[model samples]
Target chain A: MNSQDAILPIAIPLAGAGVAMLLRGWPKAQRLWTFGILMASLAMCANLLNHVFSSGKPLVFQLGGWAAPFGISIVVDALSAIMIVMVQFVMLMGCIYALDAKDIAKRYSVFMPLFLTLTVGLTGVMLTGDTFNLFVFMELIVISAAALTAMSDDRSGTEAAFKYFYISQLATIFLLLANGLIYMSYGTLNMADLAIRIKTDALAGGPMPPMFTLAMVCFFATFMIKCAAFPFHFWQPDFHAAAPTAVSAMLSSVVVKSGVYGFIRMTTLLFEPFAPQLQQVLMLIGAIGVIYGGFSAFGTHHAKRMFAYSTLAQIGFMLMGIGWGGTLGIAAAIVFMVNHALIKSAMLMLSGYLASKAQIKSASFENIKGLGKYLPQSGVLFFIGSMALAGLPPLNGFVSKMMVFRAGIEAEQWAWLAAIGLASLLTLIYTMRAFQWVWFVPPAAGVKAKKDGDSLFAPTMLILACVVLGIWGESLVSIAMQASEWVQQPAAYIAAVNPAK
Target chain B: MDIIISFAIAVLFATGIYQLLRRNVVRSALGLVIISNAINLFLLAIGAYDGTVQSYAKAIGVRSDALPLALILTAIVISMGGFAFTFAMLYIVMRRYKTADIDAITELKN
Candidate 1:
């Protein structure tokens, strides 16, 4: 497909969002429109993937038919295609789970459009090949996500939305500043053109300019903040745990992954000049985040808060894997990301059900008890998701975690690898403790477990997806591995970025 | 001129960080405004350097950099929207939680 076709997937949903808002009073219209947008996005992603692997070339779409270094362009390569598929798949699951909820149905008119807009922004971020365009896409995604978080309008949701929005704005400014530094240095905003220009002008001749390094550092810093890396993770706990569970799932699973996506794209395509040291720094941060987040999760009493911290720990593992900087490492990161998206979303859904059904506002271990007897289906699904999250053998998380650990060992980054392994143990302990308290122990004195079984189906479907994916993870891993191979070999991607050459 | 923009950004970032660490909402929101403006200025400064005109009479084959200008405009709009959001949030927090102090608004406390 041409660039015209490439831009349509994102544009269609974005346009549909506006249209849905106009039709806010019609529930069926909202569902049809939003689902149509998502379906179109999925089709576009699949088509993009087909073009990427089979052709082994980058697909470049110059907006308004303008050439690069003048007009902004969007580029989709293997890595972008992979991310598009992963994000779309997760959103599809989220939409399905959401559609089934009665409360969600009530809010469908407003929620669908906002969610679609977020999807458009995320897809745009993955595909755009321009520095300034990346910031534009980031702003779009962040704004929509904040709007969605606040859609529920509860105090907690509003609070979480506020925090997420503020911190995200800070990160966006960092991103904008970095883009500015690069443009100042290179006089070009297209990423592919910037890469070539920077390489030829800056890297080839005299000592690499201090400004280049400064820009690199700023870019890395912004991405770290966006990914909620350790030391800049202050916003995540409250934001992730307090938002409605579906939003929590999307935020934890896919939204933050965009940061990792940017890092992977930048490191592979442009920052390869300093790959070794950059990888080392990323790995160090990831290792520290893993250990820190795991312990914090272990210490937390609130269930959602505990899992929120656990997400940081899991993201640490993904970043660490990516830091290894090879086909296997990047593939490992992708696989782990897909698995986390599945399991984490499922777990949060279960948590939401518990909150709605049992009036358990705190999500403390003591607040939930005898769930196995009261809501056996949700209990079992949650247990499976929890076990998967903790990297239990034969479960999905274990498969991907093992791949990442193996990549670490292959890269001979043994210390961080060991840290990850140790973090897994902490993860196991905290996870089991949660399971024991929520599902096994008797209810605390007075609170009664809701006996109605109507609400368990959404979480059950989510868990079923996790199980199926776990059982057939190899197929997805194979596709991911191929995509990673394309990313690692950047000549094709570089060509796509500067197709005029 | 570059140095001035850089210095301004540094100050904005530092102030934003400091206010972000504080326990008040309005102050942090104001700090965010400063930071957002600083970033927008930084982007615009980068796009417009010494000896350049903002507009182009398009000689079709001739290349010029106007994309950054467009981006800056977009950034301006986005930051303005964010500013409005922060102000509205401040209003709601003051009314509902009875304070704009983040520390005092811990209704969702763990």
Candidate 2:
């Protein structure tokens, strides 16, 4: 294995975060440092993706050259590589987006450090093979996110961060307890080793203890909050809406995704036997989240909070996709994960861009009126994202939504199909209502029209990518299928981490 | 002895949860600390091979599993850091808003 490929996705950002903070006195240097680091990480992910795909197997690197199930192991499979690529790409854009925001750069010296730490934590989450290590990285993520949330200059930012921090702490406790239970039962913390033992037990006709199910339940409860599904989704709107625009892009696009990623990891790799039952429960909650988020989106006139609710709804679709339970169904879920990251991040950034330009301070529906005619570029970007999210034809959102429909039909789940259909209607309503209110409504007098510049680069590139994905839907679908293969076939992942019998 | 330790853990966890659900930010921070200790106890009790013996034993038969001890050590350090961060944030939140009640701290438009 190329050890650099296994390690640099995390190490580079960690090293850069230190350098960025040291050079905090120089904002320009910080920007350059952040951009260079993200680009390097992106490039590394590209190389690793090529290596993994060409080798036609996952790559495992045991830290300190220790054997599996003993020392820490970092596994870079198709799914991990894909997620790294997505994260690095968005982070690179977030850096550029942050450059234009200027508010963050001027006020906070720790932005680059916190951003890099967040990146490191997330990268660690994707790569680690040990559940304990996953917990460690998760704590790192929570701390970094909490600090960043508090970094927001507004009182709302503090409040939102406070809420997020507590919820995360509660999740952390659950995860730790689950880890204890699993460790006590299995005698080893390595995921592949656990999977091997589980298989061995099943083959030997041994029964799973009730404790196993209880542990799984605890783990599931944690990720549900992470996914912000259903009842646990209340904190999402306030947190996302209060963050700095670029931070919102990161949070909405990839940070929240760690939860969904955790759920997928548990179901496929560690807890497959209980998945059917858990996924059914997830399916019901997902439907509730979908409808709840959609209905809640209509109640908010602020662009950011509306999108936050919409994200809750999108998560429902992804969960429902996972719940559909087949190769195509899981693949569809992965595809939507990718598309939502792209489309939603772009939408959130566009709102921030518009907010900066508006006469009103925030992206409220009332203040940002006439932007469709006045600021045609942002209006267009917002419209495209809105249409895609609302599942319009010829958009990337429609592509993934189509796959979800296909997955539902193939699984013979008419109820899921009908639920998705209803959610789609609600999505169209909120998105269009927001769009119509922004562009078609008359502007208040004395609104200062701001000109678009290099700042437009972030949303434009993002929207273009979404459009490209839509037009080349076939390629995206096939790639998603390959990634989901990592989750669909547990043996592939297990074999990569533990090659020896 | 085992049952007692387990009951104690439950009580600590319950108190932590209750304190967290309180309206004040300081109570929330205190709850965090309390919960951290509860988690440590939970891991310790779960790792115990014998409730009758002392936690550390060099003698082979009476020895406790060392893994949870190491894990607890790491968790303690991490939780300390977590507590420091939380307390510092709490101070800042209090100073900035001039209030400890979280309900009164609602300024962000949702």
Candidate 3:
């Protein structure tokens, strides 16, 4: 594959969004166009992953034929390639699910364009090798996501979008400020260049500049907010619950992973010198998030809100894995992220299906009560998703959770290990509570299930993915292990991006 | 000049945050705009300010660092787009709720 193939994942969706907007009058054509574009992007990403794994090198494409430090570079290493593939796959599934959703289809004209734009942003975030470029793509994500959130059928959707917009804007501003400070201190926006400078500076035993530490703090705050870790998690539950189900699925799955991606990049590449200190902070926050998110999820009565809290809990686990900060820990974190994306998104979509079958189109416990009997396929799918999420054996979540537990044990983090175990118990409780309430519980008096002819293909396909990955867990675990190794050692990454050096 | 710019940035940040904490949604939105501008100014202040030669000119003497300016411009454009959408959303929210008070618009909860 050509080095320029790095840009195809981003470029395809971007150009497709414009073409889709033009085909707005023809919804079928627009859907086909968007799907084709996503498929093409996915193909490119898979090809990139194949190329990176086979070549054993990161692919770096410097725009305008300029060298890395002077120009914008698109770098696709194992980690980026894996992230791109995971995101594109989840996006494709969510797109398929959206097709069968009538409420979403009603706003298809606007939804398709925004959805494609969102793909463009996400792909860009995954591909960009520069910090400023990351900030720009993140803004693209925020704009499209906020717009899509506003399009939700829920009455609170607009309000949720409003809250999401302002908070995200504030977060990105911190990112921008951090970028400026980084440039001012190191005289480079290129991450590879920054890493080299920081490494050399730390090696020289010079006093670390206060400004750089402040910048690091800012970067940390921005990503923490983006991932919705404990204290910064207020905006997430409201936003996720009120978003249209398909959008909610995407937000919970891929969008938030961007934050995790940023954190990984920071610890593994940009700020390796500071990793020891940062890892401690991350572990503390992760423990709190695990406990807080788990209990909150159990406390919530609304199905989507409960799932949103569950997302918080899941992210907490990933954060813990990342905080463990070794080849084992990072690999475990990556696995957890991938598995949770599939499990949570599928569960969210299944809840959406349940909501669609209700008299009132809401996923509230009362509205969706006993509605699962009407859709046995969704009931089964939800069961699989819940089991996967609760870390049952023979499922993807079990493999990832086991990896995390092993890593904690290896690190001898007993307190965090206990927290993870407690949260796992809570996960089982809330997930089972939701499942029984929706699928097995008897309907309330005078509440009848709507007999809609929605297809169960999308969520079912996603659950099948969880099952397959769980059973065939070795391949993904190996791949994640490889990605984590590459992340831990930034030498190959720096060399690839700055070949001239 | 650096001191003055830093002071201005600080003041702008304080004012923006003050507005942001207001109960009124419109004020909060405006506050976000102010904070964004403050950040932009902060970016400008961080760039090399000693150069007499313009960045576009090729000179033996020190040329001004143009990257931060470019970054600020990008930040401005992005913030503008976000603010436009935020204001529009705020308008829709205000219309639906019949009040701009954030406390009054409490449909979504734990």
The prediction achieving the highest DockQ against the true structure is: 3
Clashing pairs in 2: none
lDDT of every model, 2 decimals = 0.78, 0.82, 0.89
DockQ per candidate, 2 decimals: 0.56, 0.52, 0.87
CAPRI class assigned to model 1: medium
TM-score for the A chain of candidate 3: 0.98
Highest TM-score against the true fold, candidate: 3
Q: What is the per-residue lDDT of model 2 for residues A1-501, given as tens digits with 9 covering 90 to 100?
A: 476469889899999999998998997888788889988988988888888877878888999898898788999988788788888888888878987784443468898888889999888998889888888888888888888877774556777787788788778877888888887777778988988776676567778755677778888888888778888988888898878888888888888788888877876778776678878987898788888888999899788899999999999998888887678888888888888999999999988887877654577776677755677777788889898888787889999999998989999999778977887799999888888887777766776566642277898998998899899889778877888776788888887788885
Candidate ordering by TM-score (highest first): 3, 2, 1
Off by over 4 Å in 2: A202-207, A451-454, B1-4, B48-63
Q: Model 1, A309-369: lDDT tens per residue?
A: 9888988998898899798999999888888888887787777677666654445565666
Error of 1 at B93 (Å): 1.5
Better candidate by lDDT, 2 or 3: 3
**TM-scores of all candidate predictions against the true structure:** 0.92, 0.95, 0.98
Q: Which clashing pairs does model 1 show? A: none
Per-residue CA lDDT of candidate 3, range A1-501, in tens?
899888999989899899999999998888888888888889988999999999999999999988999899999999999999999999999888888787753465889888988988988888899999999999999999999998888888999999998899999999999998898788899999899999999999989766899999999999998888889999999999899888999999999999889889999999999899999988988888888999999898789899998888888888899999899999999999889899988988888878888888888897888877667777778888999999999999999999999999999999889877987899999989988988798777877777674467888899999999999999999999999999999999999999776
> Between prediction 1 and prediction 3, which has the larger lDDT?
3
